[model samples]
Target: MSVLLSACGDDGGKGNATNTPTTNNNNTTDDETSSGGSEGNTSTGGPGGTTTNPTSTTTPGDPTETTEGESTTDGSFITPPDGGGGAKECDQWTQDCPEGQKCMPYSGDGDNAWESLKCTPVMENAGQVGDPCTVEGSGVSGIDNCDKGNMCWDVTEGVGTCVALCVGSPDAPDCAQPMTSCLISNDGVLTLCLPSCDPLLQDCPGNNLCIPNPQNPDAFLCVLDASGEEGQEFDACEYINACDKGFTCANPEIAAECDPMAIGCCIAFCDMTEAGVCTGQNAECLAWYEMGQAPPGFENVGVCGIPQ
Candidate 1:
C-alpha cells in the first residue's frame, strides 16, 4: 500500500508531478469518464490518480447473453437519466440528458483523460454498479454499459469492473460505500469513489498503491504505483506517489535528512499507537492530522517527521 484512508491522516505533502490512475489519467467517466483518467498525460502533480481508471470501458455485446469466456453482469439493469443530443454539452454530476441518453465526460479535445462532457446513449440493460460492464471507443470516450453514477474500472483491452462515481459535490466529494474515498483527478474531470486500504499491509489489488488523495492528503485512495525510480526514504520526490511502497513524499522540513533544495522527499509512515518504537533524528511518529480529525479506523495513523 502506498497510502491509507479512513482517513489516511496526511502526506504533509505538496503536489509536484507524477502519473496517477493506472499511470494514465483515465479514471473519470462512465459516461464522459466524468474524464477522470490517469495523470500521465497532463500537468504538474496530484495524488488523484493514474490507476488508469479508464482502464474504464468496453463495447457492448448481447446484454442478456454471455458467450464462452465472457463475463456475466449482476443486478437489474439501470436506466440512465436523459439529456438532449447533437453534441450538446452536459454535466456529469447532474446527468441532465434526453430520454435514454446520459451525460458523460469524454476527451472532446482529443487529448484524452475525459477533458469534456458530452451526451451519449445509455446501453441497453446498462450494467449496474459493481457489475461487469463494457464501454465503447476509448476509455475516455464516455460510452459504456455502466449506468450513470458508475464507470467501468480497470478496463483491460476493453473489459473492466463497474465502479461507482463519487456521490457528493466536487468540492466536498465522498463515497456512499463505507471505507471508500472519492478520488478527484484530471483537474476535476474525473470523480471516482475507490476503496480505501491499509498502508502497512499494502493491500490494494493489482499494481495499484494505496495512496492519500493528492487533493486531500488524509483521505487516501487506491492510485497507480507510478514510481518510475521507486524513490527511497530521504530521496527527493516531486509527487505524492513517487516513493516506494510504504513511503510517501513530505515537506523537506519534516526531516533533517531531506535535502533543503528539494521540493519534497520520501519518508516512512508510522503508527502513532506505537509511539516510542518509531524514532528519527529530529523526527517522530507525529499524528498525521490534528487529534480527533482522522476518520474512524485511521486514528492511529502517523508519519515520521519533525514537529513543525
Candidate 2:
C-alpha cells in the first residue's frame, strides 16, 4: 500500500494533522515522522526507471502496520464486530448475543475497559425512576441523578461526566429519571413509585399515600391505607367523614375510592390498577369501571361512589 505525505506545520498535535516529508540537497529524502530518524536514506527503482527512497517514512505506532480487518489487543478495529449475517453490531455483553459470538464486555485502554469484566445486570441494589436519593460517596464511578438509562454512557466518557450519545441500553441506570422510554434493566427491575413530598414526583395514582416501606425504608413506595392508621396521609382528598378531611380514603388490599357522604360510605377501599390508577371495590352495586379508568363511582349509602 502507498502512503501520502504532505508538508504541514505542527499545531502542537492538537488536531492530529499529518506531517509532511521534506527533500534535501544530497538527492535524499528527509522524513519528519517520529519513527524516521536522521540517517537511513536509500534509492530504489520504480516502474518508470530510477527512484530515490524518501527519508525512511515509517511512522511509529501506526495502526496501519497491522494486517487489514484485524482487531487490536484492545478489541477495537477500523470496523465494529459483525456476525456472519452482518446484521447487528456487537455492542453490549450483559444481554443476549448472536449465535456464533458471545456479548463480551468492551475491553479498551479507555474508560470502557473495566466493563468487560462486570457483564451482569444490576439486581440487588438497582434503583428505579422517581427515586430522589442518589448514589453517594467514594469509589463510585459516574455522577448522581444521571436520569434512568444514561449511567453507562457517562462511563464511556470519563466515569463521571455525562455524554450526548450512548450505545448501551436506555435503561442502563445512568439515564435521566422519570424515563418515559426505556427497557427494564437486564434483570427486569424498575422504579415504580417515588417520594410523596411532591405530588408531581409521586409515582402512585392520586389520593394514594406514597410512603417509605417500613420493610425497605431506603426505597420509597406508594401504598393505600384506608384505616387512617398509616400515620397521617397527605394530599388525599377526603370523601368519607370517618377519616380526616383533605385525604382520599383508600382500601389497604384493594384500590377503591369512597366518599364519606356516599353509600358504602367509609367502608369502600382503593387499590392500584395495572395501568397505574387508583380504583375502588366492595360496592353493594356491582357497577362496571374500566380496568385502568379513573372516574367517580355511583352515589348513595353503601352504594359505590367516587371519592370527593
Candidate 3:
C-alpha cells in the first residue's frame, strides 16, 4: 500500500489541501486552447485556442512559464490578510476608490508582500491587460500602469506584464480567459485570473512556474516565483509557488535532504521517462499520481522523492 504523506502543508502562501482534479476548473463550455509553444508572453492562454486579450511580451530558484489569472507562486497556497496593510477604502470589483483613483491590493506596512487594500491615483494612460506595465513603489505596491480591472503581474525589477483581475462576485469570481481560474489572496483583497497549465510541460509564459493549483491540486496553473523571494532546494516550503523555478514542495518525508523537523520542503520535479534526473541521493523520479490516474497530457509527471 502507498503510504500517505503529509500534504505539502503549512506558506509563503500555499495551495489548498483540496485535491479536486479537472481538465478545467469549471466545465468550461468552450474547448480551451492548448497552451502555446512559445512560452512567450505574446501568446494568449485562452480557451478554444482563442486569445481573449492579447498582451505584450515578457523564475525559479533559477522561472519558464509566466503568470496566470489571480494565480501567482510555487507549490501553491493563499495568504490571509493580516488586516495591517491599509484601511478598507474602496471596492475592487466596483473600482470605486474615487475618480482619478483606483483601489488596489498592496502592502500597507511596507512589507514585501501585499497585505491590504488602498486607493491610489490611477496613472494617466494606464496600461491595459496584455500591455507592458511598471510599478510605482514595489511589485506588491499595487501602484502600476495597468488600468482598473487589471494589474501588473510577473514583475521583474519594476517592470512586468499586465494581467486581468477577477470579475463577478468574490464568491463566484470569473476571468475572461476560459482556461484560467481565479485565485484570491491578501485575504480576498487581490483577485487574479491565472492560466491553467499542464504540470508536465511547465509551459507558462516567461518564467512562471507550473504546479498543482492551490485551488485544485489535481489541476495545474502558471504562477510567479516566490513573489520575488524564491526558495532553494530543501528550504522549508509552505506556498506552492514559493519554490525556485525548477523546484517543488514535497512532503518532508519524501525529501531525504529536507530538515527532519520541517513540515514540507523544496524538491525538484523529474521526468518519469528518464532515469537519474533527480538530484538528491537515494531520490528518484516517482510518479506524481497513481498509474493511469494522471490528467490527460500529464501521464509523465513525477516528483523527486524517496521510494516508499
Candidate 4:
C-alpha cells in the first residue's frame, strides 16, 4: 500500500519566492507476507502547485555520514546497566555481552548505528502504553525502554513513549487505547500506534495541533504547533513545522558541524543576496539540503549556519 504525507514547506522568503512543499511517499508491501521495509521518496513542488523534478548530479551518500565540518561528541553515550551496580558497555557489532544478554540497537527511531549501543538483558516484560521513555540520541542504537515486542516512539521532544508495533490497517488495530490509531512512519518501514486527533475539531491534548499524518492522509497525529516557545535556531525540534516562523528544523546528520542529537534543531532560512541577516554573529547563509530525500526547490535552498 502507498501512503503520502505532505512535507512542510519552507516559507522564509517574501513574495515571488518559491514555496516548496514536499510530499513523502510511503511505499509499503503486504503486511502479512513480508517484513516491514520501506523507503521515503520526496517530491518537490513549486508555487501554484507546479511540480518540478531536479536532475540528479550527485550520488547520495550513506545517510549516517556526518555533514562536512560537523564533529560528533561521544558524551551522553549510554552504557549497559549492571544489575550489581557496575557499568559495562558492549559493542553491538562484535556481539560482546554476557551469556544471557544480547547487544542490541535502538529500533524505535530510524537510527541503526551504534552511537549509544548497549547490552540489554533479554526480557519479555517490556513497558506498556503510556509509559515514559528516553528519546534515542543520534548515532546511538539499542534501547531498553520497551519490552521485546513493543517500540519506544518519540511522541514529543525529549519524550519517548511506549507503543505497540503492528501492521497498519483500519479494520484491525493493535493499539490498546480506544482512541489511538496505527500510524506508519514516513519511510513506511515501521507502523506505530499514536493517539488520534481531529484537525477540524482542534481538540488535541497539550499544546499539540491535529496535524495530517504524512504517511496516511486519512489519519492525523497530535503534534506540537509553532506558537509560544517555538524552537529558535539551534533549539531542538520534533518536526519542521514545530520551529518558529522563518526557521527550519535541520537534521544534525545533515549539519555535520553541530552536535549530533536525536532530534533536528531549528535553523534560520535566509536569502542568499541579503547580507548579515543571519541571527548568529558568526553565522553564514549556506545552501541547505535535506538528507536522503530531495524536495523540489530545495535544490538551491539556503539557511543560516555558523561557519565551520
Each candidate: what lDDT?
0.47, 0.20, 0.47, 0.34
lDDT of 4 by residue, 1-308 (tens): 11112232222221111111111111112101111112222111111111111101111100011000011111110111111111225433345677756554332323221222346664445567777654344212344456543544432233456656543242343555576655432222234455776433446654444433333323445533332354556664433233444544444333334345534445566655577877665567654432322234334345666543
Candidate 2 structure quality by residue, lDDT tens digits, 34-108: 101111111111001111111222211111000001111111111011111111223432334444332222222
TM-score of 3: 0.63
- Candidate scoring better on TM-score of 1 and 4: 1
Residues 1-308 of candidate 1: C-alpha lDDT, one tens digit per residue: 01111111122232211222122111222212223322221111222111111122210000000001111211101001112112337766777788798776555655333445677888888887678876676555678898877776655456677788776675567778887876654434556677788765667777565655544445665654434454678876544444567765555566788776764566676777775644458677766555455657766666677666
- Candidate 4: 10-residue stretch with minimal lDDT: 61-70
Residue by residue across 1-308, what tens digits does model 3's lDDT show? Answer: 00000121121121111111111110011111111111110111110110101100110110011112122211112332222234566777778777888877665553343445678877889888779888775555668888877877655445667878888875566778678866554445656777888665778876666655433334566764442343577776544454566656455566567766653466666678998888887877776655545567766777776776
TM-score of each model, paired residue for residue: 0.66, 0.17, 0.63, 0.37
Which candidate would rank higher by TM-score, 1 or 3?
A: 1
Candidate 4: count of backbone clashes, pairs at least 3 residues apart or interchain: 11
| Sort by TM-score, top down from the best | 1, 3, 4, 2
Backbone clashes in each candidate structure, one number apiece?
A: 45, 39, 45, 11
Give the best candidate by TM-score. Answer: 1
